[model samples]
Target: MTKQLPYSDAELAELIRNGDAEAFRSLFERFIRALVYFGVKLTGDQEESEDAASEAFQKLWQKREDMRGYPEMRAYLFSIVHNRSVNFVKRRSMVKAAHQTIQAEGETHSDSSITTRIIQAETMVAIHNAIDKLPLHHRDLLHKIYIEEQSTTDLAKMLGTTPAHIRTSKARALASLREILSDETLLRSCIVFFFLFSAK
Candidate 1:
């Protein structure tokens, strides 16, 4: 048997649309690794990137027949990855913010470092629970910058909104969080500590 030649991007697209499973497999083999790397660049987590890539492929396969034109297919596939990665980061950030909120409400744990870490972990969990209660948009904004670790410029580009809009959204979210927690002193400390730790 002769060794099979790799499909061109055009051939791959046509094959996929024609319900050729082998063509889809070949396309995945060709692009999955590079796509994963690109996803990680956007999401900063290998596991999340892998998941996003897998989901993108699944979506491509599912909608292959309806997909038109090679460029559009590629764009749609990547858009899935980008959106999934961003959403993943957003959820994680909301949880982190919530945990912080909870911890600040708790008493100091034992002075031992180990105990402190435990208490801090508990605090973080509590904070997450509180954030879980926030409105969807507020939680989403926090997740974009805090959990997903996206640069403001990149986030602005991704969201197709201005940096000032992002800043205002973040500000409004933080204000709402403070109101929810209803602890002025804790909110002040959170603001200070958040900036200090983030800068590092």
Candidate 2:
């Protein structure tokens, strides 16, 4: 049997443009963590970071055909996240100022905050329900990876498998979760809420 080589980022982008789901998955796995970290640095909020990263991926997928190569794709993804992060920070600041003004005027602003918390809680519940619907192994793998932030090496040791196997498992788990959370807007919101708050 001939051994197949891994695709380069450029090759993956081209394949993604051609409507290859696996190619898109490869690109997602390659850059998601780095983009999230960059977003966190930019926004200083874990939830906002996840939101920015998710938005970046969504924008990339939407414009896949326009991407010329790996460098351009990478730049575009980072740029999207950067803009989203900045915008989120600005909005947060405005909200904070509004809250302070309401408080100064002896207005009851707790209702708005309570509503926000309730929405977040509901999103978290939905995310957990979706995750719970996954196969047992996949659910466990996702929890360990995203919630516990376990290294593949550590997971491999615990599961009596190779690191490569753990990586493959993670990819599959992610696909399953994506399928279950098919509503893009809900998925984005739930993902951010779950990763930022539920994980802890």
Candidate 3:
């Protein structure tokens, strides 16, 4: 039998545009690490780098049909990630400034409100840490659906799976996250925070 060759990046892009899950996975695996490294060098923050890289991949998926070739796809991914990292830095700066302003103002807020905000922030951090410990598929699913707010139907099409299966997998992933975030207090806070904020 003649040996078969791997698909070229351009070919993979075409396949991905046609909703080939394996091709998308191959492309994601091929470039995710390099993109993350690029983001880290630009942002100097590992968490932010991962977020930027994830967003870049999500953007690629969204615009798969628009990609003309491998070179354009590669350039687009890098550009998206770079912009995301820069925006993250700017958002962080804005948050810091707001925090400083709040401190300087010495505004007397209700203790309960402050406590709730602190708990929500801490719980969000814990949730992210737990997500980082999950398997790649589960982590990606959660981040894409929840963080990026991608539609389940779109993800199903991209992954070549049914929406029901995606929902089931997401349920399992959430169960695993709940297990990982087993602290009762934090879990309760996380649930409340998600319920309140997710409605918006």
Candidate 4:
């Protein structure tokens, strides 16, 4: 396919409106990373962010015919993925109480939401740093189970252990994580950690 990389989102939308697959692909490539990153910030799960991005693009394709009146396709995509990310979190998270509490706080004080977002980035950093403080095996286990969302059976097989052991280790790792997040220095990140470690 010829390069459509130089086209603006609006131009791409125009081309897509006429059923141009290359134009749609171009827009997808252009915004996919940004959307995934945005989704990650919202949902705190890389896999879910990717799923959200995919869903957003699918919606974009279906809604291409209605693109003419929209001011910015990028913004339109962001809006869709943002909603998708929230729904993803709500559907999958075991920490719905914390999520709802944060949402309520955000609504109670509008600018507080923006402040919450800024803290979210910090919380991610804090979580990673706390994870690093764990033993090597625990760190790896936590990454596989939580970050990669691996099942206990699969993770146990990979580690040459029984699923029971994996579950026990996971519990220990989570206890350690809770301890680490409880530090006063990492106060902001605690809620994000809660939002993330849902019903696994």
lDDT per residue as tens, model 3, 1-200: 11222434456567678766666676676567667766675568988888887888888888888888777877787778767766766666677787554433222336575445334534555565677778898898999999899898998999999999999999999998788766533443343333334433
Candidate 4 deviant stretches above 4 angstroms: 1-7, 69-71, 92-200
Q: Write down the RMSD of all candidates, one decimal each.
A: 22.9, 16.1, 19.0, 15.1
Clashing pairs in 4: none
Which residue pairs collide in model 3, if any? none
Error of 4 at 182 (Å): 42
Summarize candidate 2's per-residue lDDT along 1-200 as a digit string, tens digits.
Answer: 11223433455567778766766776776567667766675567888778887888888888988888877887788778766766776776677787554432221225455345334534555566578779998998888998899999999999899999999889999898878765533443333333334323
The Cα error of candidate 1 at residue 173, in Å, is 54
**Local accuracy of candidate 4 as per-residue lDDT tens digits, 52-111:** 889878987888888773255666777777777767666565355654544422112245
Q: lDDT of each structure? A: 0.66, 0.69, 0.69, 0.67
lDDT of 1 by residue, 13-131 (tens): 77679877766776675456656765676568999888888999998988998988566676676668767766776676667777554433222223364334333433554465457
On TM-score, the leading prediction is 2
Off by over 4 Å in 3: 1-7, 98-200
Model 4 Cα RMSD, Å? 15.1
